[model samples]
Target: MPDDDYDDDRDDETRRPARRRRGPRNNTDVPCPECGARSVRPGPWPWYLGTIGAMVCRAVICEECGHEYDERKPHAHLPTRKRNLAIVINLLGFVGIVSVFVLLGVWIYFTMGRR
Candidate 1:
């Protein structure tokens, strides 16, 4: 009985640990735009990344209706104040560029005339 207990302990010590369970990888599930199915998957790799449509849009394919469309949400317009600020900044940049050119031209003319 003592030798049997020692042998059992040795077997337990040499036993491997249990394997772990893995979860899903890249399980991007969304509603299909065309068929309105709730099982939309991500588009194909590499080739899908190379297309112009991929650049300007989100690439997703509907498994139900086979419709490949941009998955991007409709863009919301900026507030009027923010739009006005952007326009003002753009005009200021233009004015600064023009002022730099005029100053350079005036300096060149004065320097050459003096020489």
Candidate 2:
């Protein structure tokens, strides 16, 4: 019985500590547009034509003020200048991708289709 008690104490000393529970990783570092608290988290998915359409928009909510906004447009209500710039950048990227495809097609037509 004394040996069993000693073994139990040794086991407790060797046991690993419980890990700290981490919050959701999505948008956690972003500051809230309303209160500026860095506790933003991805909100519940929007219900449109059910779950299929919910994937279209990503809503981020502030834990401090309970303010929710689109992830792409991080401002409180309307889009900010930074948001507009992001939109322009995304559009330029899309245009560049399309132009690449068009150039590839033209090259293929001239090289293979002509022969």
Candidate 3:
């Protein structure tokens, strides 16, 4: 191998700067009820899973005072309810698919054994 083939062609000035990734943005529209600051952001989790509990509500957290609360009307829990319902439907679909594959395997084993 020749040493001339490994030489650098481009200069540092020609290279583009690396882009910075941004995290979740603050919800400027919704203000904190405790401190009344417009620094509310989305909660860690949207649904109830493990320790994170935001079920049946659009949970939000204020950056200024660290106050957490639901963004939607307290009485109207339709949106979050619908979200949970969708999750149930998806789980059922997964179960159905797995059951179908299991049935197919059983049928194949019985048919092949007779032959």
TM-score of each: 0.33, 0.36, 0.34
Off by over 4 Å in 1: 1-78
Mark the regions of model 3 whose C-alpha exceeds 4 Å error after superposition.
1-76
Worst 10 residues of 2 by lDDT: 46-55
Model 1 residue 82 CA deviation in Å: 2.0
Worst 10 residues of 3 by lDDT: 46-55
Model 3: lDDT equals 0.62
Q: Candidate 2: where is the Cα deviation over 4 Å?
A: 1-15, 18-30, 49-56, 76-115
lDDT string, candidate 3, 28-95, tens digits: 76666677776676765533333322343566667777776666642334456546656875687799
The best-first sequence of candidates by lDDT reads: 2, 3, 1
Residue 21 deviation, candidate 3, in Å? 51
Error of 3 at 35 (Å): 26
Model 1 pairs whose backbones collide: none
Better of 2 and 3 by lDDT: 2
Model 1 lDDT per residue over 12-76, tens place:
98896877875433334455555666545665433422344345445566666766654563122
What lDDT does candidate 1 reach at residue 46?
39
Q: Which ten residues in a row have the lowest lDDT in candidate 1?
A: 73-82
lDDT of 3 at 43: 66
TM-score of 3: 0.34
Best by TM-score: 2
